[model samples]
Target chain A: MGNEYKVQVNHLTKKFGNLLVLDDISFHVKENEFLCIVGPTGCGKTTFLNSLSKLYDITAGEILINGMPVDLKKHNVAYIFQEYSNMPWLTIRQNVEFGLRIKHRPEAEIREQTDYFLDMVGLTKFQDYYPDQLSASMLQRAAIARAFAVKPELLLMDEPYGQLDIELRFRLEDELIRLWREVGTTVIFITHNIEEAVYLSNRILVLTNKPTKIKEEIHNDLPRPRNIADPAFVELRRKVTDLIKWW
Target chain B: MNQNKNGTKDNKKYILMSICSVLVFLFIWELVTDVLGIFKSTMLPSPVKVFGTFIDKFTNTKPDGATIQVHTLASLKVALSGYLIGVGIGVPLGIAMAWFRKVDCFVTPLFDLLRPVPGIAWLPVLIVFFGIGLLSKAMVIFLSAFIACVINSYSGIKNTRMVHLWVGQTFGATRSQLLFKVAIPTALPMIFTGLKVALGASWNALIAAELLASTKGLGFMINQARGIYRPDIILVGMIAVGITGAILGYLIELLQKLVMKRGWRQ
Candidate 1:
């Protein structure tokens, strides 16, 4: 009751034409916590994130942000959708500045914020290049920059790097952890990859098949800047992997 | 962009075919005139005689101030007026229909019924309503252009990417803001296609109307020339129509290209 929780999902439920997707799922995140959600294909990990972002309406239960309700009109929530919605017409710089433009931020402030994020994502040089001209990984990096530029209290990313190759994906994951630490924003990232979840998250939320309920909350007691080669980290990864496989 | 060597070769082949086609057409025309000798010289003048007569008609203006330029301008004015009016009405209606399902449901059946009846088919009714004047001819062109614009605009907006709409909503854009800023910009390219098609159809319909009912347009001049057994004037009128249509089409293409340079052209 000390108001420690930054986001609270209380018994959230969702249905698509009587096929229940999320069944009374509940979770809580401390402020600035990197919470990774892992599940099988069609398992409603995205559905839960979408409900929190108000992209999809919950059938039942409540989602709260900062002790207040998750009202899309009022809350400062940014989403990185799985499908690349990066405006093809806009350059990388312009795409990063999009949220600021929508909020009507001052020109100087928008420019500083956008430039900082572009540099952070290592895409400052490609600022003038359009999305169609960039590779899939570069495009995803731009999307991350855009979401972080707005400086939202909550960042929702749905499979942001699942489309990239293994090497690029690992590099971007490292960049993401760095950015998350620097920004201190509560991130609810949804992914199906077990190794990525184990590598990036402080705590992992595993969801079961459709009518998805929280199967386990595996807190990675492994220290920060986690070493993937460490025996403990590998054990946790295998545990989460089996939980997902048999579920 | 890669060099289209195969396409370039195709283009060269087409150029040769077109030249051969022109020569063959001329040879066939000459044979018909020389060998058959079916029609009198007054009724169907040879292509050689037609060219000479065309030059004479231009070189020697009428005693009155009327010339070929007058007919060309008159037809252009009617086509422009009809085309503009069609664009004005069709574009907004299309947007509304695509955005609002209730409106689409109410309007679609009516449009479908009317669309199948070509602009030329409406000639008898249009002439009865408006008489054999500029207004009737313009009305026919308007009808032809309007349907194309509406369907183009409707499909353009309707086919907007769902992810794009989600992006706008996530950024806190209101419904009206999304429609004007996102949907319209995304739908613009398809709408341009509609406009180009509509423009061509309107031009064709305008000439058809003038030929059927008018007194001063290029089409009417050609019809009159046929009655007077002056094939040269008819050929000249045909050339004038073709040149003018080509010019208008080229200008529209230029405008589209310029707009496309801007990101919003899509």
Candidate 2:
């Protein structure tokens, strides 16, 4: 049996008491696919990710990874939240190595992965600094490095660069793409920024407000090293913006 | 290097100011008692006389059974033993109560019931069970410190950020690993606070315990001074308790600095 999809969300529905949040959402993320989920503000985007991560128990349906139920112990899943998730007490190097250490990887492998990710994220110089001492962008970079160091089978990012400035976001997005291409891990990134969706995703999943359901699944076939100023990039960005525009 | 030098200079200036303030206070105390004769010599002795008694007690044991240093050491032995026992039991018990529902259910009701009862109130019961010796006094100090440690440790573990736990769980941390690695580390700052509170409480309770039945402690010395109508000896005992308490608090703060490594002074 061939399982083409790395993640399969089968009729996922979630409710908080009587209030419905996610309404029968179904999607498939191919192996190593960079899938961006974009929606308007207050559109249950976080709820969707929580359900996928099993942080919240779904009211109906199941989330499968590689033809099996999503079991955290059996499969490696990583999440990068918008808030700086670096443990404040740990140094940047320790933060990067946290996931690997939790998984009990070999010491040599842990050191190797920690160094590689820290270098890739351009944080090797500040590896000894605690999270509180670093800038906001640097903290996010550490979070990214930590997530990637584990070599996760599935990576979920919830607007990880939402608080970052435009220039820093672009730079980090480039680093993220580079790491993604190098590692080839399936990613489900949720954000409200249409340009960011068009810029980073291989495919964009647009969602509706309130009880969020898939509005559109637009395939993005743009060339690598996408330019925000490029007319083609602008066109795709506008298309996604139009689909999710509530105002 | 320049900043370091400036910091040292500022620290020295603060210490000098603190010493000057203490001297002003002592001068006022001397003025009221010795110079103006506002209170009787027996009621309020001059600062010089108190200092004289403090120095005399170091060498001579005429007033008390033992010297001030020996008395302090005896009090410390009882206080520390009980305080350590309290920390040993309270911290792990508090963590368990916070983390596990079964533990909380079993411990919280009884803890709440005992928490309101004063440590001194237990003196009679402790003396009856353990006999009026070092054990009874130590048990009293233990009870006082134990409540503070348990409450602080419980709140510490309870207040662990949800996101930190989520991060650990997402990374495949086992239950024990999450408790030890994530929960415990996150709870350390609060645990330190608990230890400091417990230390002070134990010291305060030690006075009451010593007042019951003891021959060699600052509290016993104070009681003995009152019986003999020697206010100078009482003053010396009070000063000794204050200085020792301040020193112990400072030592605990140092331990907090060593353990946390976050540069949090308070």
Candidate 3:
């Protein structure tokens, strides 16, 4: 059986009491695919990611990884949230190693992965600093480092750079692309920024507003080291913005 | 490392000011009782007189039937016994109650009942049950410390950020792992706060219990001195309590620093 997709969502429905948030949404993410979910504000994008990560129980449907039901114990999934959930008590290096340590990786592997990710994120110098002591960009990088260090089968990012300035966001988006290429892990990134989705994703999933459903799936075939000012990039961004634009 | 060079200099200045303030206070105390002789020696002894009695306490146990060291050691024994036991049980129980519903259901009712009743109010009952020896006094201290520790620790674990726990869960951490690795470390500051609060409560409760009904402790020494009209001995006992409490607080800070340094690396 050829399981070409890494993640499969079958009729993913979620409701809060009587209010339906994700309305029988279904999607697929291919192996090592950088899929971005973009929508208007309050469009249940976060709820979709939470359901995929199993952070919230689904009201009805099922989420699958490698064609099997999403079994958390059997498969490792890493997440980078908007809040940058680095443990305050841990240093940057320790925070990077948090998931690896929780998974009980070997000491040598923990040290190796921690150092590699820390260096890749350009945070080796600040590895000894706590999360509170670092800048907003640095904290987000530390979170990315922590998520990548685990070598997860799938990674979910919920607008991880939403709080950063534009410059920091661009720099981090490049680092995220470098990480995605190097590790080749399946990623489902949620954001409302049309440019960001066009810039980072190999495939973009556009979602609608309340009673949210898939609005469009934009496949981005731009060349690597993407130039956002490039006409094709601008064209794709305009297309995605048109798909989910409420205002 | 959190402090800068300017911060270090400011800290030194603050230390100097603190020293000067204490000296000024001592001078004023000496002025009224010794230099001006405004108060009788029996009413409010001079600093010199208190110092003399503090020295005399080592060699002479005439007034309180025990040396200052002996009284301090006895008080320490009762206070620390209750303090360690209270914190040991209270912290884990609090964390458990917050993390697990079964534990919360079992302990919260008794906790609510005991929290309102002051530790001093239990002295008569404890004294009647266990007598005025170390057991009853320790029990009195236990109630005070336990309530303080439980309240702080419970809040500490309860207040762990939801996002942090989600991070752990997304990584497939077991409940125990989440509690220990994420929740407890996140709760470190408040748990230490619980420890400090419990220490203060235990100290105060021990003294009250000893003052009401005990033969040998700093509180008993002060009470005996008051009966015998030895103001100097009373002053020594009071100073002893203050200094000891400060030292215990410093020790807790030392423990906090060790835990909070973020050096427990993989």
Q: What RMSD does each model have against the real structure?
A: 3.1, 2.0, 2.5
Candidate 3 lDDT by residue in tens digits, A48-101: 899888899999998889889887767889999999688878889989999998
Higher-scoring candidate on DockQ, 1 or 2: 2
Q: For candidate 3, what is the TM-score?
A: 0.95
Model 3 chain B: lowest-lDDT 10 consecutive positions = B257-266
Task: Return the candidate ranking by TM-score, descending.
Answer: 2, 3, 1
All candidates' lDDT scores? 0.85, 0.91, 0.90
Least accurate 10 contiguous residues by lDDT in model 2 chain B: B257-266
Pairs that collide, model 3:
none
By lDDT, the better pick of 1 and 3 is: 3
Please, what are the lDDT tens digits per residue for candidate 3 over residues B1-266? 65698899999999999999999999999999889999999999999989999999988988778899999999999999999888888898888888999989998898888799998899998888899999999888888888888898899899899999999999999999999998898777888899998899999998888889999999999999999999899889999999999999999889887777753222
- Superposition-based RMSD of candidate 2 using all C-alpha atoms, in angstroms: 2.0
Candidate 1 C-alpha lDDT tens digits along B1-266: 24698889889999999999999987777667756876566766667776776666665554223477877888899999999999999998899999988999999889989988898788899889989987888888889999999999999999888877776677776778678867887788888888899999998998888888887878888888877767667777887889899999999999889886445443
> Deviation in angstroms for A225 in model 1?
2.4
Clashes of 1: 0
Provide TM-scores for the models: 0.90, 0.95, 0.95
Local error of candidate 2 at residue B49 (angstroms): 2.5
Docking class of 3: medium
If the candidates were sorted by their DockQ against the true structure, best first, what order would they fall in? 2, 3, 1
Model 2 has an lDDT value of 0.91
